[model samples]
Target: MTTFYTVIDWLMVFGYWLLIAGVTLRILMKRRAVPSSMAWLLVIYILPLVGIVAYLSFGELHLGRRRAERAKAMWPSTASRLNKLKESRRIFATEYSPVARPLFQLCDRRQGIDGVKGNQLQLFTTTDETLKALIRDIGLARHNIDMVFYIWQPGGLIDQVAESLMAAARRGVHCRLMLDSAGSLQFFRSSYPSMMRRAGIKVVEALKVNLLRVFLRRMDLRQHRKVVLVDNYIAYTGSMNMVDPRYFKQDAGVGQWIDLMARMEGPVATTIGIVYACDWEIETGKRIFPPPPDVNIMPCEQESGHTIQVIASGPGFPEELIHQALLTAVYSAREQLIMSTPYFVPSDDLLHAICTAALRGVKVSIIVPRGNDSTMVRWASRAFFSELLEAGVNIYQFTGGLLHTKSVLVDGQLSLIGTVNLDMRSLWLNFEITLVIDDDGFGSDLACVQEDYIARSTLLNAKEWQKRPFWHRLLERLFYFFSPFL
Candidate 1:
């Protein structure tokens, strides 16, 4: 009996190794030199079981047949609208800069969202302003309102917004709300969803977590997008969470949570509406009908000289458009590159791009929080800072508050702003959206914001970084090893 058991165990080990080898070979064939594919191959070779689990959780890109069927059933109108946008872009010969044009072409061809026109943008810097604007927009909803947030807490400022949404729903305004299952788990267990539902609001948890659904996809691929569309003519996107001052605790040592959110009006709003509709369709099998073509939507007027393109990325998509766009933009930067993000676990290609850009005489500056909520992520981020500093990149830590914004200003002529973070999850795993604004005015405005953050921040010299406690540095090194999936 003992001999038989030993033989069975050996067979199982051999089978596992064979499976890992086959999967690694398949991944290499599918993705040419993508960081994600390479990382998966390494993981499978170094740690077979963990690699297999990670691959199951995040390695697969296809959303499977059930999701595809549900998407088609729920959002037939949205699909039609996307087709129209594609047709429109093909007719126009809109030109983008070399760095951004490739990404635009890729998204337009593959994702069915075209570069829209006639849109006006208003940037909000503070949470107070953002919430006020959000409430005002909610109050102005005439037809329908669609909102998706990663975090939605009740009481205080968020409660006010929740009440406003409920009030609008009571007035017969069509309202649909989607929140991430992981990020908004607290709100899900709370009375917010039920209360909104009682007020005639439709609330759906995006990417419901279930062990049985493991084959469908890992629960870690969260919908980190924050989008609000009203009446198909106005939309808002940024990094602001739906919590109030109490949650961030500004009065405490946590500092203020600064963010950037832009309100857009024009044909671009329709594109944003399509994104929300897609998420809604994916979550619920019900699709919201888009507005008729005759709806007097104007072209996006240029508020500034900068041209802007919106990039959306996720596991459902074939390519990581935003990540590719950032890498391309960073490589294209001739003078300077300034970036601000809450989490900063960049992929190998992005790291090399920044370092190589700096080596070529381009000024590189990264603004991060002094302390982040995620200990592992912070440690992993620190492990890379020394190398960046050594490569002539300047690092700043915002001391006033948690810098929750994800933005990049390149050469003062281009700006990339939106909900995506500079982390592996945002790059390859999570659903993210970013707007590549080509307006000099918008870029200048974002640069001013970054400057202000730097003014309130403390610069970490290479000497100071090296003086940190030995154990702390060791922990950071240890965390760096697991950063590929973080």
Candidate 2:
């Protein structure tokens, strides 16, 4: 019996070493960012089996072989469809300002979708206003309505949007709704999905979670994009989910969640529609050739409209395109930079870019919610504040509510607004979409919104912030150390 126990112990020791060796080899071969690679190695060596299990479940950057292949297969048709829009909506290299050209080229050269001119944009700052706008648009839809959201809490104004969608479906307008499986698990369990389906609305869940398929893909890589398209002419995108702040997360004591949405009209709406179609096809295995821009339906004044580029970022797309683009914007900012987001855990490169921008005399300001839903994210975000304050970057904590708007404005002329948050998950893991607008008119409007947030926020003092309890500082450092995984 003693000899048999000794053999079992030796075998277990051998198995542990084997895991260490194999995981180390695989990490090196993967060629991830140096910081991420080093962090994973530390976790593996220190935490033992738990770290290996975490890495195996989440370290990989795959979307499952089948989903990846489906996305690859659809690329040709998607590219072809984009090309068909060139003669009508595409802008030449010389049409936009020089400041916008580099960022535009980064996405255009990689994704083959250039900036489309003559896009009319309306920024909605309140939840009730945005929902009303969506319902009004859905009411007018004659052909089709495609909507996607990360969270779909069914209550208050959200149910009104649903009733509007159902009415549209009954009126013979084809409507398809896509919800993230994990984010909207509550809604899925409710009767809303079945209710919509019975009303002739096609409902699909994106990135469905299955425990048996855990080895095939990362279960937490969610579809975090919020998009709504009506008749391929009017589209909406932003950080706002399909939820009423009055009814969502009220118990968290963060106050009402404030959000912003951009309602768009013109040719660029078709571009946003393409994003929805790609996501829909990847999940449903159905090819959809979205109709081209209907000039008669949503006419544009080419000389005065906004130049907008839609960046749909995810696993199959170019890695860190939005992150790099944002960094470039920060580096190019000669006058000022303003940013707002609920989550603000930036990557090393992004953090450096922001601090450098401030060090170089550009007025850099970041607005974030004082009360965050995720303790880890809040701590990880504050971990970088000391460095930022030292470099003259101003941090403002909004006291009104949870500021959920995700936007970046540079030089009062260029603005980026959409689902991309300033965090590792948004920068690397989740599927996100962003709109790069190069119009002084739209940028001015967005700047006003940021200014309002600043007015309502209390500026963080460097000395006061540094006077926090030692344990608070320690906790922040600990979370920052593992922010890559967060």
Candidate 3:
């Protein structure tokens, strides 16, 4: 019996070694970033079986085989329809301002979508204003209303929006609502979706979480794109989820969330609607968007309209398009770069680019909320403050509210606004949408909004930042160490 027990122990040891070797070999073959790969290796080797389980659950971008094949199969038809939609709307090559041209060119070359002209934009900064405008549009919907959000917490003014959608459905309007399963876990657990479905609205959840299938994909992968298309004529996209600030996260003590949304019209809306249609089709296995009209509803009135390009990024895309666009924007900034986001934990390349931009004498400003809801995110974000401040980048902490807007204004000529944050999760994990606006008037408007945020914020001095508690710095460093994996 003693000999048999010894043999069993030896076999157990051999099995553990075999498992670790297999995981290590797989990680090496993946060819992820060196830092990321090293981090995973460290975790897998250090924690016995826990690290391997964690990596299996979270490390890979496990877009299911079915979804991957479906997305591939849908691309050709989607691309052709997108081209026809753009062409029918008379989208021409935009002569972007010199400062913004290269960024546009990069997106055009990679994304296969150029700037569409004659887009009229309205900027909304407050929750009341955005909700009112969106509800009004839904109320006026004639044919179709498509909406997607990362989160849709019920109650408050959100109920009004739901009522509007129900009324639109009653009026014979086709309505489709897509929500991220993980982000909207509360909503799905509640009775809202059933109510919407009973009202004849099509509600689909993207990236549904399943514990049984954890190894198949990362359960944290979220559909973070917030978009609303009404009648295929007007569109809305931004950092705002379908949650009212008053009722959402009140217990977190971060105060009301301040967000930014853009109400867009003209040809750009159709392009954005195409984005929605593609996502909707992927989620539902049904192509729902109607064919493009023979005649353009709105002609290209170049003199008075804004030129906008949509840059959608996710695991489905190639080469990290959004991150590249952001890097390009930072590199292209000749005068000033203003960025505002609730989360600021960026990858090494983006961090290096921003620091380099400031070191090269570009006036760089970063604005984040003073009180963050996530303790880990707060520490991770603050870890790089010393480096940023040393590089002469102006860092401000907004005290007014939880500044939830994600925007970047470059040289007062180009602006990027959408649901994407500057964090690794948003930049790498989540499906995000960004609108690149290359118009002087629109850039100026967004700049003014950012200026107001600055007015409400307190700028941090390098010396003062260094004076924080030692434990705080320790926590920041600890979290920063794990940021690449986060």
Candidate 4:
């Protein structure tokens, strides 16, 4: 009996190795980032069964058959809109700088959105300021209002926006509200959706969390976009959710979170409407009836603003458009670069580009929070600081509050703001939106906001870093191993 049991155990071990080899083969066929692929292989090799379970939960981006069909059905309408815009656009090649033109052109090809004229950009730095702006504009909403957000916790700023939305719905505004089930759990479980429904506001929860919804897609995929469109003429997009930043965490040394938003009044508002409509359609599996007031409903504002393109990205795309755009923009940068993001786990290509740029005489500075809520993220980010410091890249830790803004400004001639974070999940999993603007005036305004953030930041020098406890630094390096997926 012992001999028979030994033989059986050996057979099981052989089968497990065989299964791992098969999984590794499958991962290689997808051609993911080298580090990511290697990380999976390492995990699988260490504990085959447990690793397989982990991979099943996190590795796949498959959205299943029904969702795949729904997403496919969305494209024809999207293509139709793109074609219509192409035929009707007023071309002004000279409006964009030569350096910025190719990047925009690349995004135009990959993203459904295109450059639209007559759009003015307003940069808001403070949480109160943005919430006030949303309330003011929402109050002015006449024909309709549409808002899609990831997190909508019920509290100070969040409740105020909800009240405004409900008021608009009561006033007969065609108000539509969409929230992500995973991110907005607090509000989703609250009576807000019911209250809005009572007030005649349409509500849809994207990626509903349930066993049935799990079968809809790899459960990790989320809708992380924040967009607000009022009457098809004005829009707001950025990192701020309809929640109080202070509630992001409790007992963290950081008192409150700081974020940024962009207010746009232009044809780009129509573009934002299109993006929201797509999300709404996918979640409900129904067309946006009445077809969303035509893009030309308002008189063409020949001079209301400049040209800007709204870029949307997600797992559905053939490639990572946001990541590509950022990489391309960073490569094209010549003089100085400034960035701010809460998360710091960047892809290998992006991190190298940043370090290289600093080496090549470009001033590269990035501001992140001194103490993030996630201990793993904080440690991993600090692990990266040594390399950044060695390359002469100035690293600033925001001391005032949690720096939740995600932005990239190249040479102070371009500005990008939206829901994207400098992390793998934002690059690969979430549905995100960002506006790429090349207007110098708007870029200058964005730079000023960044300047205020820099003022409240503490620069970490190499000497100070080297004096940290050895165990802390070791843990930082160890935590960095998970950065490929973090």
Q: What tens digits encode model 2's per-residue C-alpha lDDT throughout 305-400?
A: 788888888976777898888987888798899999999999889999999999999999999999999989999899999999999999999989
Candidate 3 accuracy as TM-score:
0.97
Clashing pairs in 1: 117-299, 117-300, 118-299, 118-300, 118-301, 119-300, 256-401, 306-438, 306-439, 307-438
lDDT for position 286 in model 4? 78
Per-residue CA lDDT of candidate 4, range 378-481, in tens?
88888888889999999998998888899999998877888999989888788899888887778888899888889999998889998999999889988888
Clash count per candidate:
10, 0, 0, 0
lDDT of 3 by residue, 352-393 (tens): 999999999999999999999988899999999999999999
Better of 1 and 2 by lDDT: 2
Give the 10-residue window scoring lowest on summed lDDT in candidate 4: 289-298
Candidate 1, residues 35-74: lDDT per residue as tens digits? 5576677788888888887787667654556666775565
**Which residue pairs of candidate 4 clash?**
none
Cα lDDT, all candidates: 0.79, 0.89, 0.88, 0.82
lDDT of 2 at 276: 82
Give the local distance difference test score of model 3.
0.88
* lDDT of the structure predicted as candidate 1: 0.79
Question: What is the TM-score of each predicted model, taking all chains together?
Answer: 0.87, 0.97, 0.97, 0.93
